[model samples]
Target: MKDFVSVIITAYNRQKYLGYALNSVLNQTLDKDKFEIVVITNFEFNKPNYKNIIDIYDNQEYLGEKIYKGLHESKGDIICLLDDDDMYREDKLERVTSFFKTFYPIYYHNNFVTIDDKGNEIKIIEEYLKIPPYASFNLPEFTLAIENNRKTDIRNLLKLNVNFNSSSICVRREILENNAQYLRKIKAVIDSFIFYSSLLLEGNILLDPARLTYYRIHTLQTSSGNTKNIKEYKDSFSNLFKKAVEDFYIITEMLNGKINENILEIVNEELLRYKLLYKIFSGNNILIKTKFNIHLLNYYLLSLLPTFLGNLYIKDQYNRTKKVRSFQVKSSNIF
Candidate 1:
């Protein structure tokens, strides 16, 4: 019998947390036969029982390629991703299967809690996501309604501040299989690529409010591990901004004329802001001739301010963003 869900847990040198992640799957409320675990790791770790697990060892260091391999080898109707350092709640699989059975969305994402390395909850995921509390869980039944104006809906959703962590996202197997080629092209921002690709493909998405995954925040985490200074921070943001622009164009090209022009303008404006900041910190004059919006102009004027004030302003803004990007939850709340 075919498996109902395939949980792909990709690990790279995170052997310490792999056991916890794998055990979370094995201890799920869902039947053992209903789901299979696929472990894609570079090194062997103490995994759970081998009965329902498929361990694929690839010496290749790229995480994107490892994930692609797992997706290719997976044999299930639904695809769920688990980061090696993150874990699902015991009922995550159960809730996901139930939701899929009832509504059958192409993509499903649930709220997740952020945890520190010591396994203490720092803050609720919804707090960081900033999604409107009133956004309904069940989307409209008409796929065309979502497809015809996805760009606008997506822009509005982003404005409300949405986030997509891989462990919190699940996709129908067919969607991943269909988009595998495009997905393979992405190296670092695979999660963002999958999220936007699903939207552009007109795939219905179900955003569950329940916190179902434990996202661990640590110094070694990929996004947090690299930035030791302002230069690194600026480079990171620049790369992200460039990737967003690239993805925007790719999705636009794929959608033809179906995309909203207003959404394009919104993205362009956001990109301009990021570009201006990048120029400000990097001391680059590339954007000097570009048309300036109020936000960009403000940043420019701040960059020209007295050295102490400008540095203070830049440091304050950068530190605020770094905290968010690094998943530093300032709250003492525990879930």
Candidate 2:
């Protein structure tokens, strides 16, 4: 029988935490034969002798490319991605497989807990999600209802009001296969590409309320680390805004007739708002050369305000959407 799930872990210079992540997978409640682990690392290290582990090394340092390679090498009906610094709860795989058998969602994910570098719990995933208390539905039902109600989940996704952690997501292999063309076009933000493309292609997403993964937040992690200067902060936000716009266009073109027109309009409005903010904070000279509009006027007016006030606004917005921990942890022995 073919493997039921493939867990793909992409690691780069995180050997200190990789072993714990691997051990978490090895300790899953599911039978060893039901799932396989594929690790793509950028390190040359001693390899473990686990029979179910497949290791691939890439020296090029492209995260998206490594993920693409992992998908290509995966040989299972379902695919689950994990980051080397994060870990799965022992029953995550077993529960996910069982949920699939029951609801048959094309895409699925569970809530996750946030931890500090030393493995202390910072906050539960629900603290950040915009979902209402006690609101729950099966994946297929939710998707159908959303369409019937003339609402697109894509809006919530773009606003970072929903969870799309690569580590907590499990998708059908066929979804990835069908979207391989667009996936290859991605050089960064691979997780957003997969999530948006799959949903646009009419895949239903199931969100399990159980916190089944531990997402670690530390100084060395890519997204949350290394922003010591104003230039770094501006550059990071600029790149993020650019990628969000790119993904929006890519999905729009790929799912032309399938997406709602109103949804497209809404996304465009949001993009315009982001563009104005990007112009103000990014300090990119090219943005000033573009056609001016009310958004640009608003940006100019905002620029005339006290610098501290503009900075406060930006800081507030960043805190609302960033994946970094909202609270500090003082102690824990969980690791």
Candidate 3:
């Protein structure tokens, strides 16, 4: 039999889509008895005979806390994650288990497609993806990204994008058990914390390029729709970036060994543009924390940054940014 696996599906507010997600798990190509499905939620699950369901009452607001509780309840050595609104491919567990056997990665993230509330495929999210079973210390990109001295240069050259989907994350049981305290307090950013923490602990983190899950995108999921509103969207993303950077710093401090300080990586110049926006609007020196230079203008990802700045309300700052023209960018790198 395959090694026992636990699929921890968090059914928070999106119970409406829970059936589809559960169905996907139940219909896995792998043997059903090989894995247990642990549904973590605040509400009651009336489904009969599913012994793996656990109701978490307190710390109901943060998804991380619920996951922490789920970890304790799980009996599997190989842990898989799924959101209430997402679904896995039929062979997901089989493939993931196979990777665990072959690569022995402590952590795993599978590729996924972004879908709407109706399950219509919007776009395939391929964030900083690599081959199956890439260890952080072993991967050439990870080594180079940390070794680089300049912050902006590291941002530009390092292509290891960690676009983590909660449903796509799978890890060994010990990572969750060892970092119990960190996971409980992390709120919705739990996946990001686990990712960085695993990297810091020198755990083998596998980024499986196979699209094995469907990530749901719905309202309140406005981060996916950047084209809808100009200013509001940028603000939303800046707040996201702010949370992530702060979380990175927190992880670094908590795991304070000789961990690499490439933690404050900026995914795209667009996000940097918003960071610049905050400084310019708040009467703070724009270049105090950042030295936005020529290397940033190399990609096609953030050419829109300077153009967006050109349309700003502030005149002097706009003119200063106007001369700092030619901001190129690649695709938006998900952190």
Candidate 4:
């Protein structure tokens, strides 16, 4: 029998957290027969002989392909994603199922709590996501309105450009299958791909404010695993930018390169921000040829002015910095 929800858990060799992540699903308040656990991993791990039938797909492939494989194999109409290092709250599946039924959103992202490697919750933390615009009182969730033109939809979503934790992501199966092309190219920026594709395909997105998943933070993540200095930091930022650029390119292909006008304008601004920061910190020449928006006035000055003047500005900022070792060099002048 087809399940109502397929909780697809993508894992690697992390034996430590996989059990906890799986147990979280097993412990869900939802009926065990209503939802099935689909484990996709490269290696064969211990699968608990539980009442809920858990299917395993063991293969070695890249991140995108692995996700595609799981999506292809899931038997449920509603797909819920759980990363290997993350765990879901016991009520998450129940809430997510109801959220989809009422809102009928193609993509759904619930809020999540950040936890350490030891499962301790972290408070007062800086987060990667912004509060979704449409989520408000009484509603307490977000649903993107696509009442405008395609260009407007693209522009507004790209402007917002908010991404949440992967484990908190859920979607209707057909939307993901129809847009699997975008998923194929994605490696590490899965959240961005899912988000942009949902908007690109004109599917409504729902963002729930409820914390339904536990997003694990550790020193093992690729971006923070081995970063040592400003140079490494620059490299890491560059890598992340590259991944996002790939997503943009995939979108361009989807639109047959027609939205090139301002589609990449936001991405280009982010690139300039990185280059501008790198030059200021490394004592190098700022890329004066690149353009910046009005909000980035200090960056605009750094690029528009002469090379020597830009260097002086960098030096000035460096001198005023409270701690150079901390990479907390303060912002540059505006006027």
TM-score of each: 0.73, 0.76, 0.66, 0.69
- The best candidate by TM-score is 2
Sorted by lDDT, highest first, which candidate order results?
2, 1, 4, 3
Point out where model 2 deviates above 4 Å: 1-3, 60-62, 124-163, 225-234, 266-277, 285-326
Tens-digit per-residue lDDT, 167-259, candidate 1:
877888866676666665554445555665565455566767677888886645654323457556555544554454455444445444544
What are the per-residue Cα lDDT tens digits for candidate 3 across 277-301? 3443332333325455454442223
User: What's model 2's overall lDDT?
Assistant: 0.64
Evaluated at residue 242, the lDDT of candidate 2 is 57
Worst 10-residue lDDT window for candidate 2 reads 128-137
**lDDT for predicted candidate 4 compared with the true structure:** 0.60
- Could you tell me which residue pairs clash in candidate 2? none
Model 2, C-alpha of 81: deviation from truth (Å)? 1.0
Kindly report which residue stretches of model 1 are placed more than 4 angstroms away from their true locations once superposed.
Answer: 1-3, 59-63, 124-152, 160-163, 224-335
Q: lDDT of all predictions, in order shown?
A: 0.64, 0.64, 0.57, 0.60
lDDT tens readout by residue for model 4, 1-335: 33299888887665668889998999999988789888887777788898555656666434566778787776898888888888999999988777677767777777776565567665422222111212111223554434322355443444433344568788778757877876777656566556655655555676667777877655444323213443454344445544544555565565454334564564455445545544543445544465447746775555566667755654443333213222311233111
Off by over 4 Å in 4: 1-3, 51-61, 124-162, 223-241, 255-335
